[model samples]
Target: MYMNTLRKRSFQIYADHIRPYKGRVFLSWIFLLFAQIIGLVPPLLYKRFVNILSSGTSMDTDISMLVRIILLVVVVYIVMNICYRIAEYVVVHYVARIMADLNQTCFAYLHRHSHQFFSNNFAGALVKKVNRFVNSFRVLFDSFYWDLHGVVVRIIVATCVLAFLNIWLGVILFVWSILFIFVAFLFIKKKLVWDVQKADQDSVVTGVLADTIANETNVKFFVGSSREYARFETETRTQQYLQERSWMVNYWLNVAQGVLLLLVEFCMMYYAVQLWRQGLLTIGDFVLIQSYMFAIIAHVWDVSHIMRRLYEGFADAEEMAEIFETPHEIVDVKRATTLVVPRGEIVFDDVSFQYHATRTIIEQFNLTILPGQRVALVGHSGAGKSTIVKLLLRSHDVTAGKLMIDNQKISHVTLESLWQHVSYVPQDPILFHRTLMENIRYGKPDATDEEVMEAARLAHAHEFIESFPEKYDTYVGERGVKLSGGERQRVAIARAILKNSPILILDEATSSLDSESERLIQDALQNLMKKKTVIVVAHRLSTVMSMDRILVIEEGKIVEDGSHKQLLRKKNGFYKKLWNIQAGTFIM
Candidate 1:
């Protein structure tokens, strides 16, 4: 029953992708069917030629007819081949288009999932699933069109032709073909479990390898290459074992199918010999029966293989189908509208959140920031400062209460619009493997080259960028690994500056830079902060001293709220103690 559901889902996915190209699919099917029908004519012609030669009379007349028959055979073969070529061309063309569409559709759906979903799944495994989905469609199309469809058509045509000649022989062939297919189907159903398990193990191996490669630097730094190799080897061995077991099942299935074919061949031939001895069959009839019997056996054998391939295709496609059926954790409301942020005011009205039921990250959180207010959230690690920023970004919906921007509930507005009005610079910035100019331009895709350069200059990123041989054209490598930590941060700052939205967020933005570089960036940040509502999440006390307000958070609550001097005046206050601890380090 579970397999039946998976099979239906697999077909549904394929149908949805091919629906737009139904005309092309139909045309291809027609050509293939025409070719299969044309293929049946050759054996009948051969039988006629054999019978004519066997009759012992009229040599001269017979010679001329034999020549004509040979020429006709050549013509038939040429036409049949032409039809086959055309059918193949049409199938290839449409399958290519369908595979491309399937790839894009899967990629788009995978990315639309919530951030938490991505965190739970491996990037490499997801990629493998998508590729398998597209490739399985191609496998299914080939198996059906070239093997299953062709075999079925040939068997039907051969049975009809034989039945016309002799009823008993036709019945024998048709009944045996049906039995062969039924047995093959049973074996295929049984093997599908192993095929799916193998595919899953293959994905696990791929995920482990990708993880190791992505974290190669960390592995090398810790001198754990051997440990990683041992882990990868274990996964590879499991994948290998599953693959071998699946192959053994296929071998056993082939042995069973061969036995069935042998039984049918012997029965048909023995019956033919008995009829010939009784003077009810001639040499021509014998040849025809022999020809059709072999043809039927060949097709039935192909049926066994085709069924195996079809089931394998289903197994591969089911993995991706499962992903497609999963509901998106975040989705816009039916009537959601664009967010309009006229004044950069943000409000958290009695909000609460939790990752899981047992532990609450933020509870009864309430805060209101006026337009153009510069607020800093000072907290120790896991104090919910980062979670607050994430909630504002709508990465996860709140468990209770409301988060609004500019008098509009965020959940009621489009995510794109909300994101468009806010700019964020994270503590650790990850850049694409692209040129510096392109990376900065990602902030505003339509921005001119001049505008990008100007933003880079404002972030104090221009000096180091110009030092590279390619200047702004240099590739940053994956996640900006080629650049220093400070360099990547500057590029991120440049991107945010280029965005120039009404609200700016800096999450320990200057943490990566040296004191000198930090001071220079601080100047640029001051210029950028004017007339903008800025929210900074900082651990360093010096960075928050100039802000209009400081909220010292502890255990998801605001323990102290005041300016630098007001918090210092309080005896043994949380903010004061934190400031004292960090002040000595800053001075040193």
Candidate 2:
């Protein structure tokens, strides 16, 4: 079953990338075949020269005749060289182009995948898989172009020549070739599996490193250097052990191949001399066979090497195939259409969701935010607040209900079009390693300089931006690490402001900011949210007190929903109690 799947995937990969260059590839192989045949003429010419030299009569060989033969040989050699070079170039170019297309397709598919796919995968591991897969195309091309096709043609031609001269030597070399191939394949099969295991272990190590760096603040605050290092070392050691084992096996395999080659060489020469002495072959024929035998043997060994390399490529390709072929759990409906400009009415009807096998995050919940209304969600961690945002963004589909935007079912519209009308400000904003202007412009790539500055001003970020020596061009560093929390939040707000969508989602966007920064950002948020459907996930009750309505969520259920004053009047309600606690109006 595994082998069948590998074959199918390999074919799919080839078809996806190689099919476009079929004519070029076919012509290349045809020229390569002709070049291989022309290459055989050199050994034949050398054999004739050897015969003439041994005769000692030298016909006083005509200088012109010798020069002509030498020139002819040189011309054939050059043609062979040029043709093969062209073939190699064509193969490599096609391989590179195909790998690029495959990688792009994989990325596009991943972009459409539901949040669960990303949450369940290690980001670094997936990145490594893509890198390895693209690299494998080069290996695949190298192996097939030079080793598989070229070597096989040369070997076949050489064997046929030897067989016509003497069948005994032909039989011997054929048997040796079969044995050599079998032994090489055995070693390669084992090493390929080992290499894949090593790659997986390496991916785990990389994932750990990514996590450690991403969580550097937590690690440093807890002084967890030793712990993190130990974990990293464990994965590293496993990867090293697997790689070493594979290398050791490959080394011994090459040793065996070398030994077999030496034995074959010795036998071929010995038999060639015997045939010559028996008058079954001329000295020139013997020399020709000997020379061709050496070339053929080298070609055979190279074929074995190429096969081993191919196995490694296949392993990497298979790993990448998983990611490229992964199902997108959230996808547009059949015949999906682009959404018209949104009017900002959002609705969740009887929505249910489960994050894991045993955990249900939301169950049969119904909610609505009318056009131009502002709603705040108050909940503890894992109370389905963020899940609502994810559902709205179509990052994940609802398990058993409907989500709509402006009276249109979200699933019926293309995801790109859906997001065009919605802009989200996440709690932890992600900034690329680029200038501040580039990061802000990411929201609306075509925004003019004046428009960018205007948006920055509205978000209260223009002042600090101007304070920097580079101003808008200042590099934010990795993940905006060079910037303060408030600065990053303002950048995030500026991005949202630039987007200026009909629906706004502030997912604890102000959580990392100081009180003063939050106050300033809050004013910007109000302006941005004007006439838009707004949903705010708030941890601090004070931030959402004046919201048009607040929904208190607990254990995946909406336990209370009302205005602040109305909720405060109900002593038994969760929101009223929470408000009283935060207000410090109740006895501890």
Candidate 3:
């Protein structure tokens, strides 16, 4: 059953990824087989040396023949060594190329997965899985070339030589090969269970370390440093225990394998001695039997060890397989075309959505914003406001109804083309660990340095950026940790400005700024918003009141929708209550 599973999975990988590597695969096998065949020559040559030495004692000219024989052996070994080196060079180069191809495919498949997949898994763990997947294929391929090809060649050569000497000796050799391999398999099966446990424990330790470091600032602020340390220590100890247990199992298997090798050697030699005593075999035949047994034992070790490692490697590959197994949750239809939204109009036709059996976040919700209009969505936390933004971006598809831009159904358009027309500034504004210039240029990779600076100036970021010694070239730390909250928002705004998409969504983009910074950024935003359809999500009433339309949503429904002054006419309206709290006075 285990072999069946391994074959099935290995075949699937070969069918999908390995088929593209035809040239490399053929070269690797040819080089490996040629090297192994040449390697078989030395053992047979050793028989000649043993036969000569045993008989040369009484012959007068034996000394001259011995020198000649030694020289011949040296030349053979030198040629074999050269071939082995060439073979190794080609195999290494091709192995790296194949692994690289698989690595790239894994990354492409993983990135295409839905937002929920990323939200559920840890970043560090996913990276580690891809790394392990590629690395395992490398190991498994090496084992196949060296152990499978090399060992099988060695065994076949030994068998043919033995049978040529005597059929009974060949029969004994073949039986010993089967018994030894069967014993190794039994022990390897036991060790594989431990290997799986160790792998699981390793992933846990890695996850804990990454989560702890990523949240280190929170740990310090909440005074939970000691608590986090204790948690990590417990996980580390468990991982260590699993590793020790796994190694112990492997050690016992090696001991059993050594015992089998000894038995095969003793029996083969004893039988050869009996044949010599009965005059059924010559002295050279006896020597040949001894040399072949040693060669077979060496190969047996390689084959068994490689098979064991292949099992472990396949186990690692299985984890990455799970990630690949999930089909893309949101995929464009056949013949999907690029969205052409010249008017920048958005409409949600009776849209509804829920997250995994949870209460509906938005039910039968409908809204429309005309071309180039400015709109604001105001609501409390968990009021499905962010969900609406994500739906617009097609990060998550609506559970019901259609979302359209210029009459093009969002699901029917290519994702890249759809996103190309929209510029989004997330609430926290994630930034890459790169230079300020590079981070801003990410929105428009081809944008010149001058253009980047122009966008920064419009977003009110150029003033602070110029203060740094490096100016635009300054490096922002991981996730923009080197920059302050307001500074990161400005960089994000500058990126959006560079993109200059037809539609813009700003989700609490200015919530982090102080009163003075807010006023300055609002002025910049006004310039960026011109002639573009803009959707703003804000908690502060100041940002919402200036919009042409305000939407008040609660309990998965739009409770009120109108201009700020018109909505405030109702004394008990949700929008009026929020406006009064922010300004500290009711508007007439």
Please, what is the whole-model Cα lDDT of each candidate in the order they appear?
0.89, 0.83, 0.84
In model 2, the clashing pairs are: 58-61
Q: Report the candidate with higher TM-score, 1 versus 3.
A: 1
When summed lDDT is taken over every stretch of 10 residues in candidate 1, the lowest stretch is: 579-588
Clashes of 3: 0
For each candidate, give its TM-score against the true structure: 0.96, 0.95, 0.94
Per-residue C-alpha lDDT of model 1 across residues 46-81, encoded as one tens digit per residue: 777888898886999889888988999899889888
lDDT of 2 at 488: 90
Distance (Å) between predicted and true CA of 181, model 3?
1.9
> Distance from true position, residue 90, model 2, in Å?
3.8
Q: Sort by lDDT, best first: what order?
A: 1, 3, 2
Better of 1 and 2 by TM-score: 1
Instruction: Tell me the lDDT of model 3 at 165.
Output: 84
RMSD of each: 1.7, 2.5, 2.5
lDDT of 2 at 13: 74
Write candidate 3's Cα lDDT for 1-588 as tens digits: 654564466558745677776776687677667767777676666677677778747675676777777788788778777777777777777677778888888888898887888888888888888888888887777777667777778778788879888887898898888787788788777877777777767777888889888888999999999999999899989888877877787788788888888887888888888888998887767767877787888778766687688878876776676666657888888999999989999999999998885868988889988999999999999888889999999889999999999989999999999999999998899799999999999999999999999999999999999999999999999899999999999999999999999999999999888777788888889999999999999888788777989998788788898998999998899998887787862121
